[model samples]
Target: MEGAPPAKKMKTERQFDFSKCARRKVALMFAYLGWDYDGLVVQADSDNTIEEYIFHALEKTKLIESREACGWTRCGRTDKGVSAFRQVASLIVRSNLKEGPGVFWPEGTNAANWKETTQEIDFCQALNGVLPKEVRVLAWSVVPEDFSARFNCTQRVYKYFFARGQLNVDAMIAGSRLLIGEHDFRNFCRIDKNKARLETSYVRTIVNVTLEPSKWSCDTASGSSAYDMLELTVVGSSFLWHQIRCIVAVLLAIGSGRESPEVISQLLDINTHPRRPQYGMASETPLCLFDCSYDGVNLEWTWQPRALNATIVHLQKIWVDLQTKANMVRRMLGDLEELPGASGDSNGMTDYLYCGPPAKNYIPLLQRPTCDGLEDKREKRNAKQNGAPQTLLTESL
Candidate 1:
């Protein structure tokens, strides 16, 4: 038996026969509230990303066996805890549409008209059913075989939120105007200072940036009477990592008179220090992707409002209701009479000292107050006081 040549081992791996399938490219609109997730980009051995849930749904619905097999590509890599109203991804998959050959549906009852109905709105609903409550598919569209979400994108719009509290709205708006063109934003971004970073361009163009004030009101019957929530909306086509947050940090400093308005001009001038002051970035929870745009040739997708809009409204209502309850708890805590000699427990006392309603947030409002008198004097002093030139370029000498 040993001398006899061993029979060839039978192959155990299952070979998936995709050769008979006619592949078609499709683009899908993905929307998710990112507060509970890590971000949009997927990582190995990680389940806390919007992309992971998406691929899970895709596999659950038999869209693809794996992301790699589908040749999946995403338009943007949003940061941690950031939500998107509309983001895009493209992938290739076998098609059952009547327009393509080798059409096949999952094994079941055979319906000749199935291919015709695959491209309808019902497809969105069908996919959404498999997706989690936080993630939803807005629509799917058939695209040209060569279409790509990343390369074909003309612009990506990101919206950052800045809650208002004594914020110098005028100065922030003025500073935003200076950012409306192409410039090396290395100082504003958190780029990896390593040699391995290649091919990816960090110098993105800012087609436009707008800082507009927005208002929010909480329902009184829901145990809230505070109607004084103000915010700033900043829209930009493309942004570097933490770029928007860095800019907002400096502007908030300027608005509150912690820094001078002229600092903006100085930051813009690369001939000077060529670096910027270190400041904390804005909260990721407040950032949202409003929309993403691309050339018509790249895709032919229509916005399906019935489902997405309804979901958005429903979620917003839930959020508002929660906030109202929080406000109510805060008010009750504020009204509580402290027990005499409550041993260093200022607890409810601090809330009452702040007046009106109590707040659960230590820094709910981050904006700085405008200082007109001190700012005017500082401006005059700076103009009148002439000092030696300050330039890091010549500092070595």
Candidate 2:
């Protein structure tokens, strides 16, 4: 004992029995318009949402009994009324779905009715048929077990649209530059009591944030207040609740000269006390998650033209119907009010007349305490491991 060296402890590693494992790994690229649903995540007994459609397809395909059972995780949690052009979700299923070339379940319900038909159908085709028009399952891949749609993401790009009205575009883009780097964004996001479980580092880096004109001619569209569209794109590794909207509000303020570009720089500085600035959060209706990327992961995906094409056809019919109604309304109100200007405002000043004055500070749209206690403990452990400073807003002390 006096001269002997101590032995190094061996770490235990997890081993899976492939033969015994019934779980089939899967990843999906889905697109959805958040206007109708409550949110993406499924809440039992809650109304229909994107996750609900996914789980329904899973159970119908005999994939998993429940989302929890499937161990599903998503790339982002877009707010209600928001949308996603390319969102990803990963999960495991129990079936022939992962086997090469022949996975099928017949039409109609099963004997138990806990699931749908046992007919022969490709996994993607079956799910698309049952899903709603606003939501679509575009592609899928069977990824390694370690792959996480959320944790493994390299970059997430989001776009927000605002009607230009009287705001200045050049000023907005200038303010956005101040946010390009690592910073503690406590001021921009909602302080989630349960965030300790999801993220240890509140200091996420924003790779880029840019503002550009919408595809529609702002000059032509500005003649009608209802048609003007201004777009902002944000790219980052991760974002907290309400962060993007809050930042948009800040930029809008600066564009209108209600707040200076220096305000954004001040907010980025940790020493700036009263972290939350009083500012307006942009409207949620126009925000969309354009894409989410994972580096070095080779994923196979396919488009469902049959389902998507049908949806497009149906949308066109609806659009034509709406156009008729709009024309009638226009005829009824002919020359009643002054036509809007080319810059999206009646008077072309850099003032946001309808949006009101900018706040000296920022506040989240909603704030609530997390119900889960386990998440609180996780946050503390992560913070300590990551060497991040603790704060009142963070669950970890």
Candidate 3:
């Protein structure tokens, strides 16, 4: 006994049980930094996604028994490195609500009893406390049992920000205005049957699209003094894969004067130019899922003043570090600009990145290179299935 190791005291983790608590179908609003996430959905390969982290916090807080049992429905499946400000999801969660002398109320009882809860769970604080700083549970709502976050969502708003880079903001604004109203956006979006079985319709309504200067535009030092960050906000009933990015890419091309503003009209007329021309998409880092609108859901938020302050402080630290690095780059760029024969007016200020080629290289839209359009795709598929000759890209064009 004397030589034996001291009697080990077994350690226990704090456990919160929800077996008897009233459960309700609730929708939670989330905001996250997408730069580090592999998107909002949970996948087999990585637990680093926003959904994975959120579910982890939910489990730790004893809010749900399992992800499968929660009836999870995400509003959108944003691609990797895409951020969300008001992303929403519906799921069954443990509630502090009480009912008429029932601990585990009848299993088939009405799911709308979430309102009976005496006090709403302080989800923002509880989940934010456990989740990584990049992901935050902003608010939660008591939604209808029939609610489906994906199906019920009415509209989605997106914002993209970029420097002007000698861009024609007025022309960009004009180009965006052409996107208003319902149109078959097939030319604006690539055909992807996997993302949507309804690609045959290829139609979406754009409620509004506007370009405006960001708040920091008044700050002269912002963005190398050429232009501050300008944002393009688009509201739509729904969007296809890379749709917004593709639209933004075209707008940028027009802004750079490589393409005429009338090109938007030409692109919108699917009857004329059935295929999309070759072009690059805009960067993803500046695109954000600004909000998703639903008709009935009204989220009630609980603030964590103390925790929020700490978060603000952390953000300031990050901003400061980034500002330092940015200043160094700015100084280095200034030094390079002053180098002999490196006049700031290099190449007579010809465009570099956004444009495709020299002004002469810009051929008429009718003759420009084209990708497979609807008809061409159908031909290829039929050919592939029927052992017929596949349509060539040149023939399709």
- Among all candidates shown, the one with the greatest lDDT: 3
**lDDT tens per residue, model 3, 1-397:** 7789898888998665444567777788888879878888899998878899988998988888788888999888887888888888888887676642212343755445444546656767788889887777766767777789999999999988776656778998998999999887877776753423433677889999989888754335433534356778999978987788789878877887767788888899998877888665666667899999986656554445765666666567766887788678767766787789875642322243233444545655446678777766776666786999875764421
Per-candidate RMSD vs. true structure? 11.9, 15.8, 4.7
Q: Write the per-residue lDDT of candidate 1 for residues 1-397, one digit (tens) a residue.
A: 8799879998896654444334567788878888788889897767888888888877666656677778788877887888887788888765545454223343432444343545533446556777777787777777776778887777887776544444566787777677767776655665443323222455656777676544454334424223233344544456777776667666665655456666666666655534444344556676777678876664556556677675676578868887889778756644552446444232332222222453343331223221222223333344445663432221100
Candidate 3: count of backbone clashes, pairs at least 3 residues apart or interchain? 1
- Candidate 2 per-residue lDDT over residues 1-397, each given as its tens digit: 8989898889886542233223456688888878778778777667677787778877665556566756788998887677897899988665532233322233331323223434323556667677777777777777887788999888999998765656667788888988999988876765554644255556889999877778853544214544356678899988988888778877766776666777787767656333354444676766899999988887777555675576567567766786788567655544444456423233422233224554445343223222223334455557877999744443321
Task: List, in order, the clash count of every candidate structure.
Answer: 0, 13, 1
Instruction: Say which prediction, candidate 2 or candidate 3, comes out ahead on lDDT.
Output: 3
TM-score of 3: 0.82
List per-prediction Cα lDDT, in the order shown: 0.61, 0.66, 0.74
Per-model TM-score versus the true fold: 0.68, 0.70, 0.82
